[model samples]
Target chain A: MELSARNSLAGTVKAVKLGEVMAEVIIQVGENEIVAVITRSSAERLKLSVGDRVFAVVKATEVMVAK
Target chain B: MELSARNSLAGTVKAVKLGEVMAEVIIQVGENEIVAVITRSSAERLKLSVGDRVFAVVKATEVMVAK
Candidate 1:
């Protein structure tokens, strides 16, 4: 799918921690570990699991730069 | 300041586009250009401009994974 978001880091799902409303997904991208917190419904919709190949997508507007 | 956000890419400000209530910031991180949309007030408070050194920060919850 076409996405306007700029950052899309390819990675493997390392873990998935589901909470009441949110789910924390751990992705291993090279030597870096990226943690993503998403809605439990979306997580369930994606049926996310460990060992899955995915792209961690981030929107440019949601990004903040600190000096 | 300490941040809980996982992604913090160091970059230099390339451009800053100011609007009525929002501002778009373009940061050059290596070969990639990261765009950030922030409130005009925050942008003014930060005194953001071109050629400034900054770190693009993103929280985990704002990140999504696409398979």
Candidate 2:
């Protein structure tokens, strides 16, 4: 599916940590690892697992810059 | 200042498009340009302009993933 979010880094799932309500997904994008905190329901719906390929999606508005 | 958000990509401000209440900031990070939409007040507070160095900050909770 097409996404409006600008940044979409393709990576493999390195780890998945499920909390009571939130789920932490660690993705290895080249040398950098991106950490994503999503809803547990979303994680369950996605059925994410280790070694699976995924794209970290972030909306442009959610991004902030520090000088 | 240190941030909890993992992704802090260093870049230079390429352009700033201000709207009535929102602002769009385009940052040149390496060969990729990241677009950020922020509040007009925040943009004014930062006094962001062209060629300024900045870091694109995104929180883990705000990040999503797609298979």
Candidate 3:
């Protein structure tokens, strides 16, 4: 599917932890490990595995910084 | 709006560059400035401007890393 976000990083699924309402997915991109939290239903729909390849689409408004 | 992916960052709109089909939005989150490219239509719908508060939503499968 087409996404609006352009920061598509190619990484492998390092780990996944499913919760009742949410799922924590850890992706290893380059030398950096990016973590994402998503709905458990979405995770199940993707059938995410330990070695699955995925893109972390980030679309946010307020990225809080130390001001 | 509620999103399926989590990883919400509270950031400020640092800059916005609109393109024909897409818009580049730079958000300063903590010490890092996360960049997100989204559809111009979406950006316009959100009325994204400098100093706007937003959250970056990321959802991907293959986060490519050096293998």
Separate DockQ for every predicted complex:
0.59, 0.66, 0.10
lDDT of 3 by residue, B1-67 (tens): 5654434556788998999997878876555567877778877888888998776544433222221
- Candidate 2 has an lDDT of 0.88
Q: How close is candidate 2 to the true structure, as a TM-score?
A: 0.81
TM-score of chain B of each: 0.90, 0.89, 0.82
In order, the Cα lDDT scores of the candidates are 0.87, 0.88, 0.65
Model 2, position B58, has a per-residue lDDT of 86
Error of 2 at B15 (Å): 2.1
Provide the clash count, candidate 3: 34
Model 2 Cα shift for residue B52 (angstroms): 2.5
Best by lDDT: 2
Give the per-residue lDDT digits (tens) of candidate 2, residues B1-67: 6667888778899999999999999998766677899999899999999999998888998889898
lDDT for each residue of candidate 1 in A1-67, tens digit (9 for 90 to 100): 6888877878899999999999999998765677899999999999999999998888978898798
Q: How well does candidate 3 match the true structure in TM-score terms?
A: 0.50
Compare the candidates by TM-score and give the number of the best one.
Answer: 2
